[model samples]
Target: MNKIETVKIPRHVAIIMDGNGRWAQSRGLPRAMGHRKGVEAVREAVRVAGDTGVGFLTLFAFSSENWTRPETEVNDLMGLLKAFIRRDLAELHGENVRIRIIGARDNLRGDILPLLIEAEETTKANTGLTLVIAFNYGARDEIARAARKLAEQVAAGVLRPDQIDAVALDAQLDTQGIPDPDLVIRTSGEERLSNFLLWQAAYAELLFVPEYWPDFTRDVFYRALAVYAGRERRYGGIAAAAVTG
Candidate 1:
């Protein structure tokens, strides 16, 4: 079946796109090929989400620890990202997708930062979907940054000590305007968060698919949605209606 079969879409879905290097290695490629193919998967996934009317889609593009990789690979990845934004920005705007990059902007490569800003500005008013790309982003670091900013405000007497609470912290997060994900899918059979969306994913349904990111096409996305349909999300409490369907 095609990607459109994935009905009952979640409001927000986060994906941990893993296994690019491993997939490439098995094919005797230099890993860059895998990354390139994974880019195709991103497009397909976007189409499927758009078709299914998913409000928000966040892809774990690059993590804070990804900086530890060799310079060659990092450069290659950055180039691919730049190329993607340049080539896909217009198409994304045409499709009514608001392109947003959420991460430590200061840590990003200079060339990419400007392109990201332009893309965000170019698509800010789109209403179809919100695609959040996490580059140089870490949940721990985000929390720390929020805390640091709040502390500074308190020290300056601009904020009261008793006013700092979960609500206040939530509003300070990078994903302040975004809703918590209803489901999080990790490809390549990895189920762990790897420091993704710590505070936001407290009640998200986790699904680990054995397929690699490149292989995670429209069909797999539909299957995940079907699986999610069978679940009864409790969100830290019991269902009120005896939830037996």
Candidate 2:
């Protein structure tokens, strides 16, 4: 395998931590057990990213469509999220990791909203890698929400319809200030984005690994970064090497 180029590290990396339930079911264990184990993977990913010099790491923790799952399972997932924040917040702050949540919070449950707010507020001053948790996030929903905000601005005569270009709309996104992901990875061999970071991943290098989220390790993360380093990001233009060749 090729070595990871330290200088080529992505500024932001986003991951769709998939196949937690499947990982448990395949082992004849409860799906909740898989999610619990996946939490450990999340911890390792953060540490690895920080150590690898990744400035930002976005995790697709939960999607808006997740609400369609079984109520008991949903509740269990929520409990795990609460537990993770309560258990890891102080440690992350001490490590200089900034916590950022990018998702619609308009109607989040009372219990969940406060915890999310607390996590972000507690780590807002950190200077290290920013850990972005996309809880209840769906890229399409996020785009629509941003569009609605633009519409409202137009209605109030604060902006004109002709001025609602990509930049204008981008400013209204939940990830407004954050840079777009440089690489997007999905575990469990999932090749599709599944409504994760559609807008922000327009130019990201996408990688799909067969391991489930629970099986993700620092080694696997490092391997993915190596793959990313080898790719030539053309961004719709010919690579400089190609042009020179």
Candidate 3:
């Protein structure tokens, strides 16, 4: 196992939590059981992130396409979400963790929207780790929404078309003020982004782990961090060693 180098800790870490249903099915248990266990992993991840001094932790809790799942399963997921916020919001806020929700808020269920809002409001004054929850979020949709905002400004004659560059669009994004992720880890060995944070992850170091979401532990997280520390991020430029050589 690689030792995590504290000096190289990533400022932002985003995770695509996957394979909950498979984790339960492999053990001959119901899929819902897997999701419940995944919640435990979420708690561990948050604690570990805080301890590791990761300034931002973005969790892909739910995507917009998840609504296509069976109604019963969707209900189960919703119930778990409500239960998690109700049970853990105070504890998270007390820990000085600032909660931020990023995603489309239009047409969310009445009960769920209020809980998300309350969580953010309650933790707005926190100064510790920023816990970002991507709920009902899709990168493509996010980009489109941002574009529409810019278009609206142009149509209103408040902004010119030429002024709509990346910076202007970025300010309209849900993650406007947040830094881009330095590391993106996906459990269950999945390598794809699945429409999560496509724009913000332009230069993130990607890691795909074999462990399922329910089985993801603190050790695994640390190992991922160690791997990230070993990497040399050059963005679009060449490495210094190569240039010097």
| Candidate 1 segments whose C-alpha is farther than 4 A from its true place | 3-7, 240-245
Tens digit of per-residue lDDT, candidate 1, span 112-229 = 8899899999999999899999888999999999999899999999999899999999888889899999999999988799999999999999999999999998889989988988
Which residue segments of model 3 deviate by more than 4 Å? 1-3
Off by over 4 Å in 2: 1-5
Q: Per-residue CA lDDT of candidate 3, range 1-245, in tens? A: 33356689999999999999999999999999999999999999999899889999999999999999998888899999999999999999999999999999997996999999999999999999999999999999999999999999999999999999989999999998999999999999888999999999999999999999998998999999989989999999999899999
Structure candidate 2, residue pairs in collision: none
* Strongest candidate by TM-score: 3
- What are the lDDT figures for the candidates, one per model? 0.91, 0.95, 0.95
lDDT of model 2, residue 168: 97
Model 2: per-residue Cα lDDT over 50-90, one tens digit each: 88899999999999999999999999999999999999999
Rank by TM-score, highest first.
3, 2, 1
- lDDT against true structure, model 1: 0.91
Better of 1 and 2 by TM-score: 2
Supply candidate 3's per-residue lDDT for 191: 83
